[model samples]
Target: MPHTLRLTVTALVGLVVLAVVGAQAVSVEPAATPSTVVRTSETTRLPAPDAPNVVVFLTDDMRKDDLGYLPHVRNLLMKRGMTFTEAQSPHPLCCPARAALLSGQYAQNNGVHHNSGAYGGWESFDPSSTIATWAEDAGYATAIHGKHLNHFDADAPADPGWTNFDILLEPATDFENFTFFDGDSFNDDYVTTRLDERTVADIDTWAGRRPFMIFANHVAPHIWFPESAKGDGDGDRGGRLPPAEAAYAHALKGITPRAFKDPAFNEADMRDKESIVSGRPKLAPRPLKRLNLARIRSLLSVDEAVAHTVAALERAGELEETYIVLTSDNGYALGEHRFTGKDRLSDEILDVPLVIRGPGIPAGTRSARTVSLIDLTATLAQLMSLTPTMTIDGEHFVPTLRDPEAVGLRDTMLIQTGAKDPSARFPGWAYRGVLTQRYSYARRINNGPTAGFLYDRRQDPHELANLLSDERYRAVRRELERRYRVLADCSGTACNRDFGPLPRPRPAR
Candidate 1:
């Protein structure tokens, strides 16, 4: 037995040496500037003959199971490619997640660190040097449709010339009010219908000859939408539910989702409500329900829009060539943790669905590997065989797409936020978590002097249980805490307080 143990240790040591040597041999050279990390090898760069056209369909505030995917959406994806089981939005908000997705950077690295009001907006970014520009430079026509929550500077022109075409479906890119605020909202059916028409026209004109990138964003399953508040007596002017959604919502007959059927609400959520009402002087809670109903009702139209968009691609003979990505900007907090919207760091807000289908990507496979939204930039650039304009926070998920058993892919992900008073000592919170098949460990750093959360995802997927003090998970907690610090350093968001001992989250009484 002793001899066997010695042999095992020797084998492990030899493997470690080999791994170190391999890393040293294959790792790309570091960049001259500290902020940049460039890949120097040709293998790390995009290869020429395999580039494919890209189309990203971004949606707003949609849940994982909201789509008819899995046996349904899964069937569609398989017929057309890749679906990620553990895809995540960088931050659980409209602006920050979108900014990260577009810039291929985290909230801190990108100027738009938080949702609106927290860090001003994305106009602080250089409009000319976005991911769209990089794709455009690579000989792809770029265009955007649907809601534009990433906009910051209202005075700035609607189109920043990033694309050959710009189609604003409404007055503002975001549809928090559900009103079109421009021409007739229904004249072109739903927003999805408009996007479908425009995309089809572009494809027909181009005749599938030129590679193109279209960011077809949709606003559905979000607040102040068609189903959020239907019967509540509020002065909301957002009466813009499409016919299908109106029918579904009408069928609901005042039955809210299982999450919001309760009369009692979370304390924190109520406090937030009071603060918003005091600050903004919005309508009462009853009216808010009506708005929520409206938002919910609008989803059917969006879903149908997705179906039509896919059909349009098929009609254009570009179905196999075009890579379709169905994703949400972020998840919504229907009622979990007493939160009604995104912006707060909760699982419902951060965990988003990412379904992809195209050539070179496998179909009907689901991987549990945690992935970030910004990774889309690198992945798309790789698919097109074009050099990324800048190194991004997102890693290439090509390995996961090609083989479910890819090596060296991440088993953990770090979620950070800069939405804090920079003047404070421990201003922001940083979450470092290791997600295994059954468990997820999320440790909070610098969250209001002392705050953190831990979840046993296997049992409490909703995150109702905060097992920070459950001594049984001591080893797991310690390991996750260490990983958090190491990742924070690697990501360059490491703060002095990040190394501090993590506090156990208190349970709700």
Candidate 2:
């Protein structure tokens, strides 16, 4: 399977099976609509009087390729919206990516690099100025449900810019039994379904009054283990995969995942790769299928959630006027390069799913433009006609969305492998490099192996061969490194500039 493709027919039988079981499965109704109705505003002030409402579905640890599990999302959104096949997460970790999403700046500027500590977690984020505040101030009622940031609980209230917020507390990674700020806890109800229902309740109230932007975050399909001691990114905590809705647990019992055919699957060699590939053993076959089965199964509910949310907008007469964006905080690495988590600097982590459908957004077209969570945030704020108090490192790509002929705002930008310590997620690993439309490059910055590799995606899509040390490609590396230095500490306009066409990788000698 290629990086940006949907699952093939043979390997995708499980998706159909899961869909069947999911429809028939008995589930909880959208939790009793919140006691209070959603936010209501007298006016929707904007550059355009009839600007569309924005609804963002941010799934946790979902890969760009996993879009196959979504049937309704495919029919309603993908077929009706623009999909950015080349979109990526600037910092492919939980906190950093979300921080960037909220502030429109990279981790270096936002200060939330890892998952915890001074450099990580909810406390590290500055909630005063963000898309939420920009939208709220601009007259859109804003709300966020489900996961806000890791280590967030009822105790820490930063007012993080939402007019209404209901987020799960620290240790928020689980299928059930976790509590939210409102004290309404989940014991038997599936979190994915619950989040949707709760958010639908908000949509029911908020829509039709004034435009609203809701961030519906979910924690399904993330590797779940409550009893076992689980340290982040340290080999899947012994191969434990999250379970699907109980009724549909065995829906995908027997089927292969297209991801396994991905050339990077159980990479055969690592000598030419990032040092983090300290050479772990290949993932066993049975477990790989088992893990993907769980992912596919878990997503059934998310697909249903997408449908329910879209339907809710339609019922409220807000469907056509709303910009429904679906994406993930970061991508999951399913047995790629023999690694099973997102901490590494692999494309499996760097690349994420970004789909949008709304007013003026061209229908059923895939944007070749290079976009990121950071860029999208800025664009959304720009669409709302808000001039930010904070500097936005990302560029607005409205041109690409409205016209496919337009190039992306960013053709090159800095990419980093987050901290190794506080979480030890990727122990003894830290790096930064530049990513262009066709090239992937990074160099380690921590102790031990201090070198990195370069990949010309046009030729080596799997990133199997390292072009860093190859004498013929010296010009490519030179240009990449030069851009990395400028972007490593770049801010605002300077950071979002396209480095222009990549100097072509030399032909085989």
- Judging by TM-score against the true structure, name the best candidate: 2
lDDT of 2 at 9: 24
Which ten contiguous residues of candidate 2 have the minimum total lDDT? 1-10
The segments of candidate 2 whose C-alpha lies over 4 angstroms from its true place after superposition are 1-48, 225-240, 420-429, 447-450, 506-508
Give lDDT tens digits, candidate 2, residues 232-271.
5322463357768765676545667666888888889877
lDDT of 2 at 78: 86
The C-alpha TM-scores of every prediction are 0.70, 0.88
Error of 1 at 117 (Å): 3.5
In candidate 1, stretches whose alpha carbon ends up further than 4 angstroms from where it belongs are 1-50, 69-75, 78-80, 118-120, 152-161, 165-190, 225-296, 405-408, 420-422, 426-449, 470-475, 492-509
The true-structure Cα RMSD of candidate 2 reads: 5.6
- Give the total clashing residue pairs for model 1: 25
lDDT of 1 at 165: 33
Candidate 2 vs. true structure, TM-score: 0.88
